[model samples]
Target: MSFDLHGRTQRLELSDQNLRAFEAVVLESTPEGIVLSKSAFYPGGGGQPADHGVLLWQGVETRIVGVRKGDDLHLIPAEGDPIPPVGTVVEAAVADERRSALMRTHSGLHVLCGVVFRDYGSLVTGGNMEPFSARMDFNLPEVPPGFKEAVEDACNAEITADRRIDVRVLPRSEAFAIPDIIRTATNLVPDDVEDVRVVDIVGLDTQADGGTHVASTKQIGRIKVAKIESKGRGFRRLRITISD
Candidate 1:
C-alpha cells in the first residue's frame, strides 16, 4: 500500500490538505461505514483525530463522525443516518473549520516538539491533540529554571519567524537517514511500509508523519503553554492551547 492509496481508495487528503470537497463513487457501504472510490477525509493517526464531515447523495446526507482504518479506509457515519448504497455517487466534504483548526494544532505540536528537543534535549514520550488544544508528554527528569515560560516564548517566536512547513514522500532508506526521524517519540512505521511521508518544519524539525498540517509555522497562530504536570518518574506532561 503506497502512502496515497488505502486498499482500493485513492487517499486524496495526503496530497491536498486544502481540499474540502470532492465527488467519489461508493465502493462499499454499510450502516457502520462507507468506503469511497476516492476521499479527502483524513483518517486519524499520529495523535491527530480523524476528520468529521458529510456525504450528500440523492438528497440524503450521511454525517461522518470518524474514520476506521484497515485494509480499506472506512468512513464511520453518524448512528441512525442513512447509508449510501454501493455504487452511489456522492458529494463528500470535510468539515473545514474543524479541519483547519486541527491543521494549526497539529503544526503547533510539531513546533512544540521541535523547540523542546532543540532547547531542552528532552525526548517526547507521547502526545495527543484536539482542534486548538493539545498535550505533549516528554521525558524530563528535571524541569530547568523557567522552563514553562521559556518554552511558550520560544514557540511564539518561531511562529513570528514564519518558518515554512514542507511535506514530501520519500523511500524508507532515504527517510530514515535523516537523524531527526530517529529522535521522534514515535517511529512506528512498519517494516513493510516502503514509502514514508515526511513533514518538515524548515530549520526546525522533521518527522515521518502521515497527518495533515498547515503550510507554515505562523499559520499555527499563537501557542500558549497552559500547564505543566509531573506524571512521575521523569515524565512531564505539558498542556497547550492555540489561539489566533
Candidate 2:
C-alpha cells in the first residue's frame, strides 16, 4: 500500500499499521529492519504510547512488538529475514483496538485540559495515557473544593457539543501565531522540527501535538474525574476514567 504522510486526517487510517501488511522496499539496512518508502507504523514519540504489532516479509512473520526512533526513522524488527536491498517493499499493520482506545484517551485528556484552563487558568505540567485512563498534572495551589465536579461538567458539555477535532501540519511561523500553541507543555513539541502538527478542538482547545485522537469530542464518551490527589506545593493531579 502507498504510504500517506497525512495519516492524522483519518484516524482509522492511522490505525492501519497493524491491519495491513505492505511490501516495504528497504531504503537503508541496519541490524534492525529496513525503512520503506511509506510506513503506516508510528515510530513512537511525544508522551503517547508506542505502536505495537507485527511485520511480515518474505513469508516470515516477525513480531514488531516494539518501536523506537533513530534520526527521525523507526527501528523495527528484522528478525532473521534477509534484509531486502534498498527499493524493497514490506507490509505493516498496526494494533487497531489498542490504538483506537489510545485515541479516545488522548482526546479525552485534551478536553480535560481545555476545561481546566478555561475554568481555573491552570497549566498542565505533565501527563500520560493508557487505553482507558489518563492522568494530568496541573500547577494549582489547591483544587477548589468543587473543582472536580466543575471539570466533569465542563468536559461533558464540550463532548455534548460534538466539537470537531481538526489535525493539521503547519509551518513553524504559522503555528507560533496561534494563541493556544504557546500554552503546550514544553516537552510535548519537538523543538528541532521545522513543521508542527497541531490538534484543534473547535471552539474548545488547541495545541501542538503528534498523538492520534478521535475526530470529534462526542466519540470520547462520558468522562469521569475519577480522583484528585494533592501533589503539594501548588500542584495537583487529576485522574480520568472513560467507560467503553
Candidate 3:
C-alpha cells in the first residue's frame, strides 16, 4: 500500500486517549470515507471494537459510523453523508461512554488473565470483548469446580488493590529481554515489528497489547464471571461482565 505524505494519519489516541477530540486537516477524500492528518478514532483490532463518533467541519457535522486502517486510517462516515474534502480542518470525537466501557472491560479481562495464571498456572489461549462484556479461553483440561467463583473473587481483589496500568513502547530486543512474562503466545508478534507496545497491569500482568485500557484496576469496577464452558479437550472458556 502506498500513500503520499499528506495521506498519512497520525494517531493521537495512541499517546493520550483522554484527548477525545482534536482538530486535524483532511488528507484524503474518497467516496468511501476521509482520512485526517491525525486521528483519535481507534481503528479497532486485538479483539476490541472500533470507535464511533462525530466529525465536525464548519457548521456541518456527520456521524462517524466506522473506522478502518489501511495505507491510511480511514474514518467512515454514516451513509449518504458527504466526505469532507482534502485540506478541510475538522474536529473528531470518540464515543466516550462506549470507549470507557471497552477500556474498563479490557482491563478487567487482563485482571482475569492474571488471576487465572497466578492460581492455575494456565495461559490465555484467546480472548474477545464488547463494551462491558468479554470472554477468555485458557488451555485447561476442564473447568475446575468453583473456578468461576474463585476467579470472580480474585479479580475483585485485584480491583480493590487498584493496581496501576501502564503502557510502554519498547524496542523488540529490549522487550524480548524481559523473559516473556506474558501468559499468552508471544510468537504471534511478527519478527519485523521492531517496536512492541506493552500493556502492564503494574504488578499483576504484562503483555504485548494494542487495545485501550483504564488507568487502574479500580476503574474496572466489579467483574462477574457469568459462565464457564468446556470447549473440547484442553480448553475452557470463561465469560464475564462488568458493572459498578
Candidate 4:
C-alpha cells in the first residue's frame, strides 16, 4: 500500500523525505509505545527501512526504536523510559543523516527500475535497500554480455539529466488511471484504499511508492552496479550502491 497518511485522527503523517522533526500531542501511551497526533518518522515500507530518532519531553530523551501504523505509533522501548501522559506535547526528530541516505538510495532504485524497463522491457519483481545500497530483481532470461556496462551508462545519463522528482497523493481512481502505476506491484494496494501516493521521476518513471526520495536525480549523485546474480528460471537480481 502507498504510505499515504490517513487523516482519520488529525495526526499528520510526516513527509517521508522532507520532514526532519515535528511537534505532536500524545493521544495514548502504553508499555508498547506512544501514539502521536502527528509524526515525521518514516514507518519503513516499499524497500525502505523504518526511521531512527528520538522523542523529547520534559528534558528526557527517549529513543524511538521502532514505529507502527505508518509512523502513527512511535515505539519507544522501555529502559525505564519516562512515559508522558496523554495529551502531552513532545518534540519528535528523525536521524537526518540516515533519512537523507535512505531517501537517495530509494530514489536510486527507482531510477534503476525505470532505466532497465525503458531499455530492456523488463519488469521489477522485487527489491530491497539499505541506507545507501539496494538490489532489484527482474524477470529476464539472462543478462546480456556487457549488460552491466550498458545499464551503468544509461542510468548515469539519466542522472545527469537532473530530472525533477515529484511526489503526490492522488485519489485511487485517478492514480490507477496512469499507465505506469500498474507496472509496479499495484495489486499490493488494498481495495479499501481510497488514495495512493505516487513517486514520479518526471518523463522517466512513475509508480505507486511509499518511501522517501531525493528532490531530483542530481541529488542521487553517483551510482554503481555492484553485482548481478541469477535467481534461476528467467529471473535476475541486480545490486547497486550509491557512491561518491
List model 1 lDDT by residue over 1-244, tens digit each.
6679999899999999999999999999998889999999999988999999999999999999999999899999999999999999999999999999999999999999999999989888888999999999999999999999999999999999999999999999999999878555656788899999999999998988899999999999999999999999999999999999
TM-score to true structure, per model:
0.98, 0.83, 0.94, 0.91
Q: Which ten residues in a row have the lowest lDDT in candidate 2?
A: 1-10
Model 1 TM-score is: 0.98
Better by lDDT, candidate 4 or 3: 3
Candidate 3 wrongly placed segments (more than 4 Å):
1-7
lDDT of 4 by residue, 1-244 (tens): 3444443233243354577888888887886777777777777777788788888898887777766664355555445777778888989888899889988898899889999989888888888998888999988887889999999888888899999999888999999999868555336787887888888999999988777889999999888999999998998999999975
Local accuracy by lDDT, each model: 0.94, 0.72, 0.84, 0.80
Question: Which stretch of 10 consecutive residues in model 4 shows the poorest summed lDDT?
Answer: 5-14
Candidate 2, superposed: residue stretches over 4 Å from native? 1-23, 28-34, 78-88, 185-191
User: In model 2, what is the error at residue 29, expressed in angstroms?
Assistant: 5.1
Cα error, residue 106 of model 4, in Å, equals: 0.5
Measured by TM-score, how close is model 4 to the native structure? 0.91
Per-candidate count of clashing residue pairs (backbone under 3 Å): 0, 18, 0, 1
Error of 3 at 19 (Å): 1.5
lDDT of 3 by residue, 1-244 (tens): 1111224777777778676889889988786878888888878877788899998888888789888777777888898877787899998788899999999999999999989888888888888899899999999886677878988999999999999999888887887777555577446677777777788998898888877889999999999999998878998899999999
Ranking by lDDT: 1, 3, 4, 2
Least accurate 10 contiguous residues by lDDT in model 3? 1-10
